[model samples]
Target: MTVLLTGLPSAGKTSLATAARAALLAAGHRVEVLDGDVVRRELWPELGLSPEDRERNLTRIGSVALLLARNGIITIVAAIAPYAHSRAALRAAHAGVPFAEVHVATPVEVCRRRDVKGLYARQARGEITGLTGVDAVYEEPLTPDLRIDTTLEDVGESAARLVDFILHGPVLSSPHGGRECSGRF
Candidate 1:
């Protein structure tokens, strides 16, 4: 299964991914997180933050996620993935795999306030270009498998909710299929 987590900068995408990875690992699942920042820094160091570079980066990550999922490895991807078309293409490319899109819907104002890296401030001062939710637009997910509003939920709660979603399926039941459940937050 491949869980593609999308959101604006500082929306807790990486935090949720890390927590989910830890929870999944504790549950005996083979899990890995492909974080966009880490990937950009490590794997595709030459890729800039331009539109073309974003596409190339996403393509590489999507391909890697597809490959890992096909081999029964649970892959969690934390990326901005600002373009709807590109995300749709990624979904199509991973057809037949258990792919879940999780949108971490955090407001731009909140993200800017929590900007640990000062990315939003940099963009405001003209020090950075192509920053999502600032200069560049982030195409919000129309219909995501899971949607977490970070403003309303803490990171631990959100991560646990996502873990529950993945383990019990979209309907929110027990992983062992013991009883049907409902009312997932």
Candidate 2:
């Protein structure tokens, strides 16, 4: 199973992924969180925030995620993934796996205000280029499996809901797995 959490910067994707990883571990599930920031700094150090670079980064992450899922590991990905086409490609690449897309639907204003990493501020000051939801574009997910409104829900609540969703299957599906996934968050 792979849970891909996507949103703009400061949208709590990392926090949610961390919480979900901890909860899944407590439930005796082998979970791994592949965070974008850490990946950018450590693995893809030469990659900048250009559109092509971002797509390359996502491709690398998606490849790792698919591999982990194939090996029965619950992979949690926390990435901005600002392009809808790339996200769709990822879903297609990992078809038939228990893939869930979680959109951290935090408002841009709120995110800018809570810019813990100062990304939004830096973009405002022209110090950072190609910032999602700021100088660059973030193509919002149109049919995400889970759309968490971070402005309304806290980290623990969001994590709990995600855990429930993962453990019990989609909220619209039955315990026997007889139904197709149809519900949206």
Which ten-residue region of model 2 has the weakest summed lDDT? Answer: 173-182
Q: lDDT tens digits, residues 156-185, model 2?
A: 887887788778766421112122222212
lDDT of the candidates, in the order given: 0.82, 0.82
Clashes of each: 0, 0
Candidate 1 per-residue lDDT over residues 111-130, each given as its tens digit: 88889689998898998888
How displaced is residue 96 in candidate 1, in Å?
1.2
TM-score against truth, every candidate:
0.90, 0.90
Off by over 4 Å in 1: 171-185
